[model samples]
Target chain A: MKCEQISELLPDYLQGSLSPDQRRTVETHLEQCADCSEEVAIWQKLSLLPVEQPGPASRARFEAVLQAYQAGRSNQPAHNSQWRKRFSSWNVFHWLRSPLGAAAWSAALLAIGIFAGLRLAGPKPPSPDLAAMQSELANMKQLVVLSMLQQQSASARLEGVTWSTRDQQLDPRVLSALLHTLRYDPSVDVRLAALDALSRHSAQPQVRSSVVSALQEQQSPLVQVALIDQLVEWHDRDARPHLEKLRQSPNLNPAVRQRADRAISKLN
Target chain B: MTLAPDEDLMLQVRDGAGEMLGVLFDRYQTPLFNFYSKLTGDRTLSEDLVQEVFLRILKYRQSYRPGTPFRAWIYQIARNARVDHFRKFPRQTALEPEMLPPVVPSDSAQEQQEVELLRRALRMLPEDKREILLLCRFQELKYEEIAALLGCELNTVRTRIHRALQELRKSFHQLTKGTAS
Candidate 1:
């Protein structure tokens, strides 16, 4: 092969993309030519530069971008107004009022009513076993929802959250959101609600530990009371240390202190 | 509600869901920026190009099809932005390793200097060849993707990349010769 023809194929040769015949010719030429060999090595080096793994700053930039996206989404209308309009045209209420639709709606409400009544009547004191199971289900659901949310647009996910009644037992996604809010939510009421949803899972050692930690860390008396209530249901010896700490904590609200006192009595 | 998929997100943006554009921007900004940085050999220009690519993507979102590979589509935008940049300010010559500032030092100065020498030699090649080499050898893009993005045939992408590497190799040898002398 002429020098020019061989040179043109050097990139392919370096990348091992050259055909066997062309590769043989290049290999033969390189054996006789130091210049061509060195050229091939340089091309090899260019290909080897670590271009894929972005540096820390670039990762930070990416995170900032995601955060900005979240913030921007928050500023827009909370729901897809167009979707709401479309759904309105479908007149879900009108459909639900039809005989079959009314039957389904009544059946759903009756099921919910029965479940609520059973829960209220049978559990003046929450069952540790049921709470633990509910919490586990919630965590699993949250993971699935998070995975789904990542795949979908923020607005659609937010709309789903806003429209749907919070189901701590069945919807792990809602539980995840509640758990997240409990940890970082600015509103004491929301945090307390999150803690209540989280309490359903306190039979799990991790959930119990998290509740105790949140109780200790939280400055809000109401949230602390909610945590103490959760601890009372836990009946775990693991909760003893936190209950003791809450008992001695002078800054704690009297109601919270009273709850902690009762929880400590139960633990002992 | 489940989060919309990538195609759905793009469709939302295309249909005037302006806020959803941020999601696409968030998704791609880092990889695209890294690609631009390697391509331009300038961090500042790379950052600017990243923003420009997204802005253009937002402006032209209406043209995008939902079912397309979002990565390829976004990259096509980025590739066009880089081309437009080059047309506006043609470099006097390809950048030498010395012309570009050091990012991080390699193990030995000699080794580092050699790498720099290779980089500088690369900068000296014609723009089309430099880009093809960078995309294939540096960015690791497939010939087909490169062909699609560059509006060329797959064989042409391969051919150009091969030629670019040859040109870079020849330049490196000359540099080494001068150093030896």
Candidate 2:
């Protein structure tokens, strides 16, 4: 057999997966083919490379991160530091007791009543530019979602994620912001919500790739598992490697690994 | 007593058992260190990257699900961590051939020389070829797993490996023949 034919079987042969006859044929070819024989020899000898140990401080660093992670989790609510700063001086009880606050509360109630009255009113008379008005409303809502996604408060950001899901077609700007939130949001809850919102738009290639990339960057096991399930639901054969890579991480939660494995199998 | 599997320990880590990560750190730091060290030929950077990989695990423990192999999942992180680091701070220095070292000094002088020549040859291949070889040969990733990791077909992976090996053989032969002359 020509080397081309033998090359087809060589990788499997090297892996020791070949049948006896095929293996013998390859072995015979090897006796006459110095280059092929030498290739196998080189492969066998690669094990000669030494495995090196990391410096001792490696464990200490890991310990620090683990401790910090737990400590941070314990103090998580407090760490929405930006929002906390804004809310700090505005004590709820103090504000409620103040005359100025009482006046402000009355004004808020009056505004709510007015808004409700407008909402309850029947649809406006047909206008010359109803499409323009609808587009303006959509732009306003998307602007709200984009701003809320950046809010210092996790719940508001989560609500922003929830609001995003209501739109059948996400504005590109809103979609990118949701993708950003999915990847970098400090709160796992908000990130998961963003993932849930974006998962609805898998028909968009951007959504699929962002979710796959998030599989690498995402820290929440719940979100990770959900991402894996979404990929499987889409039958995204492209996501198999990302899932496989996810399973390969040494620091993985076993549950997420199992989910990635199952997703890979299902996709396969 | 049987040691708990890495995956189970990871599950523990995910569920607020922060100390469980220490066990994993102990288990993986060396293999990961060697992977980066060999691939990049920079021991200091490799050590830093290994530390970074574990830190990411702690941060992303919620990302770990139970159904996959823990080793593969961590490798996924390890690969990304390295890629991201290089992306942010691209390497200015090309890898040094001598960096692929401590070739075990055995009794056969000729064998040691051959090993030395082989390391240089391995280093000489293009970055991707060297990486694929490292992932399969050194890291022990199965072909299917490599195919997934590389985002290529299984046959493409096989052909690439064969071509990589072919290149290594040619280089080693040339290096060896040069030494003989």
Candidate 3:
């Protein structure tokens, strides 16, 4: 059997998942090729690395979450401000208490509200300018609401704005909110929006720094490309080394490379 | 009136239950975090993703079914989050299969070195293959469970796992040859 074919079956053979004939073929190759034999030995040893369990930080985070729950329940008086607050307070407390309970309540409420809202709000569409105004007003209100929500229940507040539209341009306050969301928002959608917004205004140093920070720490190659694209636009000579590092990254998606190459070309 | 265990909690949080959700987070955070860490190769991003996954769970808590294994449901959420993350930031370079790090020469001093090398090499593998190996070897998930989690056919899972291991083996061979030279 060719080395490549035998090589393909090595994992299955090791796992005893291969057919008897295939296994024999691979075994024959292994005996003949010291290189393949050594490869097998290394895999066997590499597999022995201890599978790490969740560290203390994870448990601590969970404990803190439980504390937050207890605090929310014992401090129920905090929810008296508005109808939204009242609903959120109750929802937070219930969610803290039981998953099944929360599901049932959410399912019922969503069924009523989402269905009713879709039905009622569907037909009477407002003018685009009015809609934009309304959305902007809501976003402005959400800024305060999101801040309060963050203090009270950061996770929930973040969730509420995960899919929120970007209407604030690069206003400092709005930028701050987007930055906070990029760093702490629980929704990838929100994070992506923050990235997108920052990319749009990549000329600012603060925006550039945040995007670069996210890029350095980001694992998602897609997000990395977004940051790279922005950096490319900025034409920051300081960014060339970082771009080079990305060029050498084996996991970098090819599409990202084409863009990176173009960016590097621009830098040069 | 004191809230009934389920009813009181349900009524109190009609919008959804904060405390009950904590239990769910406690149960699955580690596996999910580890999975994301492996997938993203960045600790900070993984942590962020984990928190985001929980946030999503909270946002959609009302949609959850009572008897479903919370792990499976959360995994589905995590998978969706990952897909969305990828969609937003598509990669520029073609991801090459990573080579394995050279093995430690059976000495005690070399053990730690070997382990570090192995970890780095593991990190280098294509994301899909690395994920499969991790699910099978580290998480010890059954093939069927993995197939369900990955949304692929059972045979596809088997093939991918086999291919990943083969690639790792090849990488290791290359590393050894390079070192010996």
Candidate 4:
């Protein structure tokens, strides 16, 4: 074997995963090459070194997190309020919690109802100004959704992603926000929700590329599977390289690996 | 009937049996801490990262698919937590001998010196090399799994591991020469 080939196989050789033929080739190379032999010895010695053991405090910290998680889980009221407090603006309860806010919101709704009734009564042909007003309203909603999506709270982020899907036309800003969430959101559900929101815009080349690149960055298996499924459904040949990469990874979820393999074959 | 695996247990956690995560926490806390401890060379920080990882797992449990492997999923979270910590504390060095607790004690005088040299060599290597080495040698992850977790090709991971070890050896030799001088 050439030195480059031998070097490539050295990790597997140490791992005892090399095929007999491959192992024999490496063994022969090492026998004749003094440099390679010394290198192999170094790897062997390094492998035998002991791992640093974590102290009891590590377990103590884990249990504390576990207790907090369990506590949050068991107390149903806190869970609802916790989500509400973080995303109150996205929910009606936030406005209703204060009578003044509720009264102002009610007045605004009544005014909008009166305006809509007047527009319907006029029965005029669609005007450019009204269209502009409607588009402006959509932009405002998209802005709210994008801002909500950027919130640190996962539930609030989820609310933002869900809201984004309701828009008939996605603003470029909304699309970018969704892509960011898909790539970097701390919560898997938020990422998945971002995927759902982005799936609607997948026909756009920019959205397609963003979603494809996210496949490489996403570690959550559920999100990975969802990305694979969307790519396959979209027949996005651009996803071929990313799918192949995932296919070659040994630690991938078996089901995800299978899906990736199938996606690669289909895309090919 | 065969018992459910970690993935199933995680799915249960995903499905609202939040208490089930305790089992996983007990199972992975040490391995996870050891991974961070080796990677960062800081026991206290490693513990904090471990805690952060579990908390993320709980917070994101709803997104855990039933059939996906839990180990890969959890490690992915751990990797993210570590990466975030590194980004947040960019000024911190990865592996400092003073911060790193000693490994298992060596008996013979020469053996102790060799072990110390090896440890110093490991800590001196760049973060990426040290990380790959730790994953392969200490974490016991197969190259393929590491590849998957890292979102890279298996050959890429294997080559990286080979190169990492070579760099480590060079560092070890340099340290030994400096000591001899």
Candidate 5:
């Protein structure tokens, strides 16, 4: 039989699924045909390529990811997320329909009316010390972020990280808080969000350094991927050595290791 | 006693036996890692994708049904994870000579040289052909499973495998002759 004729049987033959008669036919062909025999030989030789094991840390990384996934799952039940949303909105409507809600609504309206009356009928308090008031409002926003960052719920902490990104200039304390969250947040979601928020502030030298440090300290693969991506986005060549160090680290998550290698290449 | 089948373990995991995933992970990680590393020539990416496959298994565990073959199902997920990753991070660097796996020490110089040529020849195949070859040869996926995983007919899978071998054989022969000359 020609090589073409036997080629049809060769794949099945390699798989050891051939009928005895077909197997003999291919074996006869292989003995005569060097090209076809080489193909079989090459397939056999493929096993010579050693099997590489994932680094020792792979399981630990999976544990971390699984824990984070389950924690996220518990907070918002999987498959019932839309149901939870509808239920919460219905609860809000029910609360608003209560007598207590009506009274509170009435009091808020009355207070708004009296405040308007006082503002229009009384003196205007000399322009309200505009700059100081604005500064105080900024302080208030940062304070909310700080408190939110300390919240026990990962979602609230995630929101806190989001809130931190709304300001053009960050308070030192809030910046440090975000850095800490990026480094040590128990929840990978919160840590990723913290990284996202801090990514926009790379103009700050401190932001760059802390992120590089986080690249080393983060055990979660997701956050580590984000950190390296951020450094690459910023085109920070100084991160090269840090990435190398990370790539060299024992038990580093494989995803992060890949990103670091990619980032190092891009920055170079 | 026989070990719990992957399908049953996966069903338990689906039914909320989270610990069962550890068994699945341990059984599959090395083969899956080799699958990715050989395909992409990137060990780190391969390892990461292995983790991704498990995470996705957890996320989509509900989709798994009682009769579904767990190996086929997981390979389906594995293929998607890799596709999704590349879709997100497009390939930037083509594999260079420097990027090949370090040549493993072998019993004979000729074997070592042939191994080096084979790696280069395999790398030279277009990714789709390379992938089909890897799925069958390295991954040990059966033709029927590959057909289903690739969403193609069984015969097509066989034909593709044959064609991939032809391409591989031609490349390997040419490389060997070039080195000989």
Candidate 6:
């Protein structure tokens, strides 16, 4: 067999898919050709190379992404139904149709309001189980928020940021996801919502530093102003340099620059 | 009967059975990781790319055509994920030893040296040739299947693989020569 023809068959030969006759021909050519023999040896060694095992972190990251996707899928319908159930229970039109019922309902609401005021005045503290339940619920809300923040829809991401404000207790993942949204979310509304959510967690040192770090990267004037306000409120002196940079940036929005200027002086 | 095919699992995922993707992920995660690892020689980046590929599959599941080969479709996504990653991080093309698996006590010195040389030589090959070679030799994909995945003729795939092997041979020779010197 000609070397040219043998070269064409080399791929199949290496794969062991070549016919016996073809393999014999290529082997015959290799016996006489030093270069072709070397080529075959190279491929033989190449095919024997070991596969690398991915680190455990790879699987963890994949599971995280898959779980986020699955959570987003499952909750999409649940979210719609929850709002439906909430509004469906209002029955305002039915209440208006019956004046007696409306009066009774109003009296009940007044009594509940007075009772709630008394409870507030007495400062009834939550039991341990209740506090634990609330904490678990907060963590669940954080997961949902993190999942929604990954959605393609800007409104969904905005809702995510809004959901993060449902409880005072914050998950570190929720804080990071909020900060990520603040830094990278494409929609101005989503970023603004994230900035607002982060402000709610401003007391946490990590959240404070995240907001301070995000301040240098934020472009929108409204978000920049909001972040500057949070940093100034926190009295985060570490933000002085970034705020100074924002104040001097040529493209700094006038409103944002003013906020940054005031924030810098406050920190100083 | 053989178990439910990957295509069926993916179709289920496309049809709102999102958890079915777990099956696909378990099946393809390692292959996809090895694919990226071979292409970039960066384990961490390869893992990220594997995750990105699965995410893309989920995101674009609606576009999957029934009766198409699931392996090819997934591999196509894998290739695109690697390209997109490189596009985003252009300066990360240089292969680092950090990507190589940690040496075990059982491995011989010569074996490790040969593996290192092979890796360096593979890295020296042009990107397309290296990818085709890896797909064929390492991933064990048939040339015809690759042709279908790449939207090219079978002969084109065969010729590309052949030439890629030749180029790799030249690279291996040069690398070994450099080592000897």
Accuracy of chain B in candidate 5 (TM-score): 0.92
Badly placed stretches (over 4 Å) of model 2 are A77-268, B96-108
Better of 3 and 6 by DockQ: 6
lDDT of each: 0.62, 0.77, 0.60, 0.74, 0.79, 0.72
lDDT of 2 by residue, B79-155 (tens): 99889777745677786765555444445597778867877888899988989898888788889888877789999
Cα lDDT tens digits for candidate 6, A1-268: 6778877888788889988998888888999998789878888887567877888766666665566555434534544223223223243344334454455455555655654555576566456644654555455556566766776555556666887888677777887888788888876556756877777766777777778777778665545656776677667888898888778878666545655776677677
Question: Which regions in candidate 3 have their CA more than 4 angstroms from the true location?
Answer: A1-43, A52-56, A63-268, B1-27, B86-108
Displacement of the residue B90 alpha carbon in candidate 4, Å: 2.4
Q: What is the DockQ for all candidates, taken in turn?
A: 0.16, 0.38, 0.15, 0.27, 0.45, 0.32
As a whole number from 0 to 100, the lDDT of residue A225 in candidate 5 is 64
Model 1 clashing residue pairs (backbone): A141-A172, A141-A173, A142-A172, A142-A173, A152-B3, A152-B4, A153-B4, B94-B123, B96-B120, B97-B120
Interface RMSD per candidate = 10.0, 6.2, 5.7, 6.2, 3.0, 5.4
TM-score of 4: 0.60
Q: Candidates sorted by DockQ, descending order?
A: 5, 2, 6, 4, 1, 3
Q: What is the TM-score of chain B in candidate 2?
A: 0.89
Ranking by lDDT: 5, 2, 4, 6, 1, 3
Which candidate leads the pack in DockQ? 5
- Chain A TM value for model 4: 0.55
Candidate 1 segments exceeding 4 Å error:
A1-39, A48-268, B1-31, B54-63, B84-109
Better model by DockQ: candidate 3 vs candidate 4: 4
The TM-scores, one per candidate, come to 0.45, 0.62, 0.45, 0.60, 0.59, 0.56
Q: Fnat per model, in the order given?
A: 0.35, 0.78, 0.20, 0.59, 0.63, 0.71
Per-residue CA lDDT of model 5 for B47-75, tens digit only, reads: 87998799778756767989999989998
Q: What are the TM values for chain B, all candidates?
A: 0.74, 0.89, 0.74, 0.85, 0.92, 0.86
Q: What is the interface RMSD of candidate 6, in Å?
A: 5.4
Candidate 5 CAPRI level: acceptable
Candidate 5 ranges with C-alpha deviation above 4 Å: A73-268, B97-108
